[model samples]
Target: MTRRISKTKQFIMMNPIIQFFKFIYLSLKVLVIVAGGHGGTR
Candidate 1:
């Protein structure tokens, strides 16, 4: 029970940073896709 509690706390602490990195990764993927499409059109 104590281990589970600690694990939950660690996950909660890391959640925001994980979300931030995921957002950055998704935005970068979109940007690359858009740039590729634009380049193809040109």
Candidate 2:
């Protein structure tokens, strides 16, 4: 039972780390798009 509770806690803790990395990845993609002059040269 204790192990199950700890596993749940670990799962909860990991969710935000995954979300944070997703946010960073999205922001970097946006930055790259903007830096390329909004597809003007494309």
Candidate achieving the largest lDDT: 1
Off by over 4 Å in 1: 1-14, 38-42
Tens digit of lDDT per residue, candidate 2, span 1-40?
Answer: 2465586767766798877987899899999988977445
lDDT of 1: 0.79
Angstrom error at residue 19, model 1: 0.7
User: What is each predicted model's overall lDDT from 0 to 1?
Assistant: 0.79, 0.78
The regions of model 2 sitting more than 4 angstroms off are: 1-14, 39-42
- Mark the 10 consecutive residues where model 1 has the least summed lDDT: 1-10
Distance from true location, Cα of 14 in model 1, Å: 9.9
